[model samples]
Every structure is written in structure tokens, then in C-alpha cells.
Target: MSWWHWLWESEWHGILLGRWMVAVLLLVMGLGLAGLLASLLSRFFYLSLGKTQEDITRRELHRLMRPAWLFAILLAVLYSTLHVLEFFHLSTRWVDWIHRLFQALVLLALGLLGSRLLAVAETILASRYQQANEPYKLQLVHPLFTLGRILLFVLMGFLVLETTLKVNVGPFFTTLGLGGLAVALAAQETLQHFFGALAIFADKPFQLGETIRLENGTVGTIEKIGLRSTQIRTLDGLLLIIPNKRLADSPLENLTRTPRRRVLFRIGLLYNTPETTLQALKSELEESLGQLPFTIEKPLICLTNFQDSALELTVVTFVDPFYRAGNSSTPLSFLEIQDQIAERILRTVRRHQPQTDFAFPTRTLYIQKSSTGLDALSEVSRSGK
Candidate 1:
């Protein structure tokens, strides 16, 4: 006879306060049971997954269990929430709020879990890829993992805003345009650096541990490549941080790419030396360099120039590129190598040919002197005569 009685009698009676309370209690009890079941299922899944030819340990088993267990818990929470909501028919005023709350919570949890999982995955991949020794494939591991995680977080954030909060996505996006533009402007340099890093990764520019020279003449070995800047170890034992944008735009010279470095120089062989000795000099130079382990097989000898006092022999040889391994040997920078080779050639030449002189720039000078006293004496003698 009453409105409450009529409402209770209708098909929508499940949404009443009493029915909702009952549903809540059921949800709680069901979630607890599900949690226990999930724990058991997780252990089973982990054990099954790890069952390979290799031996498995308890610690390894626990490590394997964490991901599946986390995923199962997430699913259980989502399932219980939806079922409870449906039973109470919260398809009305409170539906959006309840859905959003669950969705936001799930997304937050997923973000946390995904980050940890991504990190673990990266570590494993890096170790395996390094051991695999496939240079091209190994390079891609970090980029792929990083991009995947970034996309996941971005998508999660958007879902939380639109689906979870029940916001009109179109209008919200339109409003965000101005804010996004401002952020872009503020971070333009950073964005450039990020893209620059991506370019470096994509184009296979100088990789980590390779020695490179920037256009501005900053030469160093690349220690780390990051989103905005690169860390470099200078020849002088200092660490240099260079912005990625500059690196991307600048001319980069990768010294370590080539197995051997080409060395070119002109050495003077004194013209005063005999024809037979000059012929022998060439053979001697080639033979001596050929004996050195670092020198390349072909020793390039070019008759470059003939000055008044010297016949310049262009000495060109290739040397195996070497990096400083430790403190024992002299750290071989390119300049240092150049100086060493020049010095070695001079020393070797001097040892072989003591009579052969190294040429220097030739110069000639003339001077005239006049005596004022002699001129005056001549004039007085003429006057007396």
C-alpha cells in the first residue's frame, strides 16, 4: 500500500539499501576466498612455468611467482568489484563513481607492477643479449623495453582520466591542448635532446664505450648515452657531459669503428745521402715497420717533395687502433699515437743513417757596412794635396 512497499515489490528491489549491504558482505567474503585461491594458483603457475631441463631453486621459484601472483590479485579485485556492483544493481547514480574508483585503483596498481616487471625484464634481456654476441640485436634491447613501458604508462594515465573519472574525453582533450602546448614550449630543448637520442639509437651512431669527437673538438669516449645528455670520459681523465641535441646536429667522428687507423706523414731524407743508401733507406723503413706488430701489412711510401737540402719521403702506414686498457701502458690517444710514430721514425732513421742529415729550412742573408771616419780622412787628404 505504501511507496516503499511498491518499490520493494518491483524488479529493481535489488538496489535497496538492505540488498546493497548484503552484496557488500558477500563481496568481502568472496574476495577473501578468491585471494586464498589466487595464492595457490600462483604457486602452481610459477612451478609449472619454471619446469624446464634446468634445475629450479626456492628463491628462483619465488621470483617467478611474483608476477603471476600480482596479475591474479588484480583480476580478482576487478572481478569481485564488478560482480558485487551488478548484484546490487548499482547501474545508476553511484555506478560511475564506483567504476572510476576501481579503475583508478587498478591502474595505479598496474603502473607500479608494470614498472617493476619492466625493470626485471630489461635486466634479464641485457644479460642474455650480451652473451648472445649479436651486436645489432643487442643494441635494440634497451630502446624497445623503454618505449614499451613509456607507452603503457601514458595509455594508463589517459584511461584513468577518461574512463575511470567519467570525464568527457573529447572536451577534456580540447582543454588540455593549451596546457600541452605550454609544456611543449617549455621543454622544447629537452624534446630535441630526446629525439636526438632516439636518432642516435636508430642510426647506430657511436655506441657506448666508443671514442668520438664532436664538431667542437671535444674528443672523449662515450661512457653513457641518456635521453638528454651523453657522458664522456676525456683523454685527460675528466668526465664530460654533452647535450644530445648538440651531438645529434654536430659532425661526429667515431675512431673505434675502424679496426686500424691510417697514419700519414712526410719525413725528410737528406739529399746529401748516396743513391744506393737512399734506395736502401726505403727498404729499411719498410722492413723495420713491417717487423712491428702494430703496423699494417702495407707500408705506403710516396716521394712527396724534393727541397734544396732534403728529399721528403711521405711515410704512410696503418696501425691497429688501441685503447687504454689500464695504467701500465701509455694511454694511446690519437694525438699521442701520432707523436709516437713521428718520434719512432726519427729515432729509427737516426740509428740507421748517422751521416744522413735531417733537413731544415734554408736561408741566405747579405749586409753592407760604411765607415764615417774613413770618408772624413779621405776628404782631408784631398784638401791638403
Candidate 2:
């Protein structure tokens, strides 16, 4: 008999083919129903949640729905597989293939669903940790969550390849290591910058909106904190780009961290001023600084120097550091403060020591006369006064 006629005449083939077709139709219908239900649920869930809710919560709920989808698909596959097997009368060859395929699909589904569930759990946990009363702020929690995400996705990828694709992980890992090494070599500087950025974010040497002094004396307000660099706006209205590696390694002075700015300075006066005047000058200088709106009291002013030509008084005080360095109302620059202090000193000195004069270097001119009376008479006769 011909092979086609033989196959068609066989009782087993007839029953199995008929049952297989029915099972296929059933699986298709089941999948359609499940998809419709899942869609409706997802739509309702999303609509109820609203756009105003936190992104984390929204993403987490979506991730959590993945398991429900997997379950629906799994039920359809399982039902279809069973019916196909029974109809084929337990044919070992095709049955084994079908079993392995179902097993692979189940593993893949579980892996994907598990990953989504883990993501949802992680989001929920992170949000809870953020809200909890803790010693560290929410900034500290970001790194942990990021690390968790990386690890989870890497693990999920490995599982899918190993269990579902049936690939050997050992040699794959070896090849991955070599590939990673090459990539590391090619992007060493970029990697360094990335880690440097991480260090900056973790250590917080300078925060957003804080004033910082660079090693090279560039003082600016940090306008942006990016992954690779920081952007700053200077007092001169110029923007600065500072690399993350340099910022991580360099010594930075954060002016905003301190509650008060200590000003240690000296004011000079004419040495001819008396001790009583010097003492009075010191007290008045202290009082004057105290009267200034920004300067903190009680000011410490002392006659610190008794130079040959001038007296130097030391003034130490604190001020509000937030005051702009060059603004009109209480400029924070060293030169401006010195000028203000100098003006105050001159006013005080003028009021107290009206006769006292400032000292300056001078030379005396001498003319020797040959015979005092004769030379004087000859010179007086020869030249005009």
C-alpha cells in the first residue's frame, strides 16, 4: 500500500489527528479569552491608579501583573499539551519533543515572570525605605537600588539562557569575561569617570546650589550635577565645566557648609598715634564691625603689630557666608572688606588724632661750605634765594 494511504487508513492516525486539531483550536480560543481579560484588567488598573501617582508605584504594579499573564499563558499551553499527548496515544518521539518544548516555555515564562515580580518587590521596598525615618537621606538609598537592579537583570538573563535555551553557561561566562576585559581596556577613562561620579554622589563633597572653590581659585555656584561633570556659574556670569574625576580627586572648599564665615584680617594705622589712641582705635574698630549688619559679634580686635612706620590692628569676626562676594549690600570679597575696614579706621583716626601724621620715607640734603662765612657770602652774592 502507498505510504499516504497507509497513514490515512490507520485508526490511531485518524483519532490523533482529529484530537490534535481540536486541541489547537481550544488553545487559540483560550489564549484569546485570556488576552482580552488581561487587557481589561490592566486598563482598569492603570486608569484607577492615575497619572499623579508615583512612577515607582505605577511601574511596580505593571511588573506585578506579569505573573498573571504568565499564568494565563501557562494554563493554555498545559491544557493543549495534555490533549495532544492523549490524542496521539502517547507516541514517544513527538511526545518527548512536545514535553521538552513545554518545559522550556515554562522555564522561560517563570524566569520572565519572576524577574518582573522581583522588580516590583524591589520598587516597593525601596519606596518604603525612602519613607522610613532613617539616619541617611533618600540620596543614600539610590545607589543600593541601582545595584539591585543591575544584579537582578544580570541574574535573570543568565537563567533564561541556561534553563530555557539550554546553553552551557561555563564557556559563555569565559567568553563574557574576555569580552568584558576588552571593553574595560577600551573604555578605561570612561569607566573611571563613571566611578568618580559615583564617589561624588556618595560622598557629597559639594551639593547642588552650594558655592565651591576649586583648587585653581574658581569660585562658583554649582548649577548642575551630572554623571560625568559638574556645571557651575561663576560670579563673573560665566559657566564652568569640571570633570567628575577631577572633582572627585581635587580638594574642594564648600563655602555653604559652614554656618558662619570667619574673617581674620588686619587694619593699619600711623605709628605716631599714642597707645591710648591705639587702644581706643581697636575698641572702636571692634564696635564698628559689630554695628555692620552681616558681621557677627563680639568682634575680637587687638593691637597686634607695632611696626616702625605703622600700627596694625587684628580684627577677627564671623559673617553670613551666603552674602555674595561682590554685591553692593555687604560684599564678601577680601578687598571690599579691607576697604570698608580701612575707611572705618581712617574715620576713627581723623576724629581722635587730628594732629597725628602718617609716616613716609625721607632723605636729608647736606651742603658743605668751604670757609663757612666766605662761601656763604659768595653763594648769597652769586645766586638768588
Off by over 4 Å in 2: 1-137, 140-151, 158-169, 185-212, 220-249, 270-277, 292-294, 306-310, 320-385
Residue 76 in candidate 1 has what lDDT?
56
Give the per-residue lDDT digits (tens) of candidate 2, residues 99-183. Answer: 6666666655555565555555555556665667331333444556556656756776677577656778999889999999999
What is the C-alpha local distance difference test score of candidate 2? Answer: 0.66
TM-score of each: 0.63, 0.55
lDDT of 1 by residue, 1-385 (tens): 9887666455545455544554566567656676565557646644664533133443454464456455657565555656654735555667767656777877866875776556556655665667776443456677778898898888788888887766667776787898899999999989999888888767877877788877778778888888788889988889998887888888888988878888888877666667776676678777767665567667877678876556788888898777463564844667766776777677767875655656665543334345753322121111010
lDDT values for all models:
0.68, 0.66
- Model 1 C-alpha RMSD vs. true structure (Å) is 10.3
In candidate 2, position 274 carries an lDDT of 70
Q: Which residue pairs clash within candidate 2?
A: none
